[model samples]
Target chain A: MSSQSVVFIGAGNVATHLAKGFYQAGVDILQIINRHFDKAKNLADQVDAQPADDLNSLMKDADVYVVAVQDDAVQNIVKDLSLPRGTLVHTSGTVPLSQLSNAAPESGVFYPLQTFRADQELDLTQAPICLEASSSETYQQLKALASTISNQIHPVDSEQRKTIHIAAVFLNNFTNHMLACAEELLSKHNMDFDLLRPLLEETWQKVRHHKPSDVQTGPAMRNDRQVITEHLDRLKNEPELQAVYRVLTESIQRKYS
Target chain B: MSSQSVVFIGAGNVATHLAKGFYQAGVDILQIINRHFDKAKNLADQVDAQPADDLNSLMKDADVYVVAVQDDAVQNIVKDLSLPRGTLVHTSGTVPLSQLSNAAPESGVFYPLQTFRADQELDLTQAPICLEASSSETYQQLKALASTISNQIHPVDSEQRKTIHIAAVFLNNFTNHMLACAEELLSKHNMDFDLLRPLLEETWQKVRHHKPSDVQTGPAMRNDRQVITEHLDRLKNEPELQAVYRVLTESIQRKYS
Candidate 1:
């Protein structure tokens, strides 16, 4: 298992983080493949792996061909790969496991469930790696590879993975947009965005211990119509934000009342 | 300043935390007044202060009288207080400073900008206290009392404080509801909420260093209609959640595209 090799088919944020994690965990990275030769070479140098501009140049002998490309590009990448059956996998949550059937008989998914930034250091050990495969043998090999970098390995099928992915968007992507809206609101009032940092930190802390509903507080939760009116009135200048406030307020009210 | 005394006119979450912080900072908590005698007695015992079940029993000589009641009750409590013209203050974000003008001449605000739970211990040093007063002298006095517990004190007016309060809702309360929605979505699939903890922690970490807009990522931000369609289709059963998803998706698309 320690001698298992993985070839990354994309040099993106997920690929960069996964490559570093696998390299540190003693998994051999045989090659970095991407349409952009410079980007491929950049990641290859970091992991001491060979760089290939296309699948034709990829080393087919690697135990795993991790196609960590965009969701749309995943199928094309898989179709071009001339790897042995049961050796190809992609890091996607929405794409079905059956999408890999034409490429290999034993294809699977090796998805890491965390947002990645190329400039920031990622602690993969803390992230849960989701594994799915067409066959039990492929699942075992994928689980073994995931276990090297993370203790939390989940055997989630494509359907369940899609559910997790959508939820992640709500928690991570939508929540970040809320922060942006807050920043914009504060800046318009000449207030520092730093003023809300402690509150934001505490919000996360509360969810970690209590259910979000049990710990819910604010105008809508309390049914304080006055405060809700004031906030909505303030947001009237921005119709989009006003709509967001209205929908969320109605949602919270429905949940509580 | 060490001889400064304050009378708290409530025993709820904010009042309890503020009283404890002032007591720890060596400010004398003269009394705890509440309509609920048992709650007043409970907080009074913790701070070694006298407990009063009515405003008539409240100590009149305290340097600052902190009326930390609910938003709707603030004005009523202030009008009922039989204190000196320049000693009454209230802790509210949206309520104006003028709300206390009829109750006292030296009315001011000592609003701490943090969410509180009575059962949880709060470190005031990290929470900024927003201060406001009718007079410069009163402002200095209120600032001095707030400085005892927290180093971060901002002299924000009623108008600006209202704006900050609205923005805080967007960041803290609304973002939390988003987490609740995510939790509900995950639970429907029999998934463990712990799987999203690392992602949540990382989301907060990223905001601490980068602008939310600069770090934004997802199907909405990328304008990937396919993934968005898949997510919305999955959420079809929960119409409320589906509306929220569509609104947020449209909001993100508008922001980025």
Candidate 2:
């Protein structure tokens, strides 16, 4: 596996982290390819890989070609790439494996299921890499590649991967938005957001051992109309927040009561 | 401070945890008072304190009286209590110190800033205890009591405490609701919510060092309408979740863009 080389087709957060992880795992990263030459070079320097500005420079002998661009950019990039059959794969949860079918006969998905920030170093050992391929041999190759970095790997079909991606949106994207709303609410009252850190930590810890529905607690869970009314009244000035508050409150009440 | 005997007015989640903390810190828990005799006796047995079903059995010699009842019940319980002047404090963030003022002249607050579950044992040493008192001497005594269990103590005023509580609702209550929504979405798709554990852990870990706003990532933050629309479509049958998704998406867009 170490002898089999790979080339990354983007220099974004996902690409940077995946490139670093693959490099650390002793897989030879052959090149960093991107339209933006400087960004490609930047990541290339970190992984000790050559930077290429266009598809014309792509290494044809590489065992794997990972397209880790934005979801919308994936199809276009894969279509333009001239990789050998079964060598090209895209790293997207929502995009279907069929999207890659037009680009290469042996296309697959190597989606890492975690949020990536270029500035922050993530431990990929714990991240689940969802894999899907057009053929079993291609899957075995992708699994071998993914197993180099992550211990948790799953073979999910295209439809299930899309479902997982939607779940990811709810868990990561929407949850982060909730935190941002929390920070905004705290800022308006001149309260330190740090004050909520312990509770935030505790909330995450609870879900690790208990079912979220079983562990849910709040004014709405208890059907405490007085407290809910008080909270809603407090949010009168912020109509958007008030809508969120009311909808979630109603949902929680329906679930519990 | 170990010699300072205290009486708890309720044996709910907050009362149980605080009593355990105080008892562990070597402060003598003199009595556990609750309307329900079984609960009072149950908590009293654990803390090695006397159990009382009514305020008529309240210990007059106790140095500090902690009213840890429900929010609406605080004033009523405090008013009915018969204790020495300046010995009363209520552990409520939203309830004003003045509520206890009518019950005792030296009333204050000893509110711990963390979520508590009756069945879960939490280490109070790391939990922030917000203190407020009517007089300097009472404040000093409450501070001393708080220092015995927790190192993080803050002298927050009534208005500020209310603001803090509201912020807590947003951070803890609403955030848990978001996790619940995520779990529900996964359950519908026959996907394991455990698949989200790493992402959830990462989200909390990221916000610890960075402002949630600075670290926010999602389709909404990136203004990726295609993915957002796909997610909304997936949640078509669940209108309540769709409302939550739309409002949060709009909020994130407003904040970032």
User: Per-residue lDDT of B1-257 in model 1, one digit per residue for the tens?
Assistant: 44688889999999999999989888899899999999999999999999999888777677888989899999788777566644688889898888888776578888888999888987789899998888898888888888888989998988889888988888888899998888888888898777888888888788877877788888999999998998999999888889999999999899889
TM-score of each model, paired residue for residue: 0.97, 0.94
lDDT, residue B2, model 2: 40
Tell me what TM-score chain A of model 1 achieves: 0.95
- Each candidate's number of clashing pairs is 2, 2
Interface RMSD over true interface Cα atoms for each candidate:
1.2, 1.5
| TM-score per model (chain B) | 0.95, 0.94
lDDT of 1 by residue, A1-257 (tens): 45688889999999999999989888899999988999999999999999989677877678888889889888777666555643788898788888887776578998898989899898899999999988888889999999889989999988889989988998999999989888888887888888888787778788877767678889999999999998899788878888888998999999889
**Candidate 2 local Cα displacement, residue A93, angstroms:** 1.8
- What's the DockQ for every one of the candidates? 0.78, 0.66
Candidate 1, which CAPRI tier?
Answer: medium
- Report every candidate's CA lDDT: 0.87, 0.84
Model 2 per-residue lDDT tens digits across residues B104-171? 65789998989998888798887999999888888889999998899889899987786677677777
Worst 10 residues of 2 chain A by lDDT: A78-87
